[model samples]
Target: MLGRLAVDVAIYRDRVQVTERKSGIFIDQRADHPFSSDTQLVADATRFEHALSHALRQILKTGAYMLYEPRAVVGPTDPALTPPERALVRRVLQDTGFRRIEFEDE
Candidate 1:
């Protein structure tokens, strides 16, 4: 892929999975623990974001700073996600600095 194509983010209620599409560097992490939280996802948006950002940084070869310019495919596939929940997902991805975002279900 040309300079790292993109990353795939799949967020579950209690877990988040990220894959760097080019290198296939993937991370499947619980939403709690190091970030500190209950098992429920989105319960604390900051914590969820922290955990996600952490996962992304771990997979991105360059670093989390590289997040801003990259295209990201975010698919939150639990029960198809409600509109507000989808909006939350988008907002979080945007907050993570992804310049381009696509939803797998949309």
Candidate 2:
């Protein structure tokens, strides 16, 4: 995801001749977090949330306040995310101060 975001940033930086002052963030949450068979399922939620927060921070360097437009976060619905995990993700995005956030399962 970071790699893709890097490529996008490069493309945007090159194509943008003027300061648009508006940008959008679209996150594709298709990657799965690996866990050992012995690991408890309960721990997975926290780990995933932490990793997600770290990744988002890395992608949005200056922080969410820098984003001038709404952000959309999408993920697959096959595996499905537990309610708690989804709530955690929403909280993280909100805490980052995103002007608008939309989460959809595709």
Which candidate achieves the best TM-score against the true structure?
1
Q: After superposition, how far is residue 70 of candidate 1 from its true place, in Å?
A: 0.9
Against the hidden reference, what TM-scores do the models get?
Answer: 0.76, 0.41
Best-matching candidate per lDDT = 1
lDDT of 2 at 91: 65
Across 1-106, the per-residue lDDT of candidate 1 in tens digits comes to: 3363488988776678898887778899776644322443455567778878878767755543343378889775755666766677778878877778899877
Error of 2 at 66 (Å): 3.2
lDDT of model 2, residue 97: 47
- Per-residue alpha-carbon lDDT of candidate 2 for residues 1-106, written as tens digits (9 for 90 to 100): 1212211211010011111123444333222453212322223444444444544554456334434543534333333545664565456546654445444552
Residue 45 in candidate 1, Cα distance off native in Å: 2.0
| RMSD from true fold, candidate 1 | 3.7
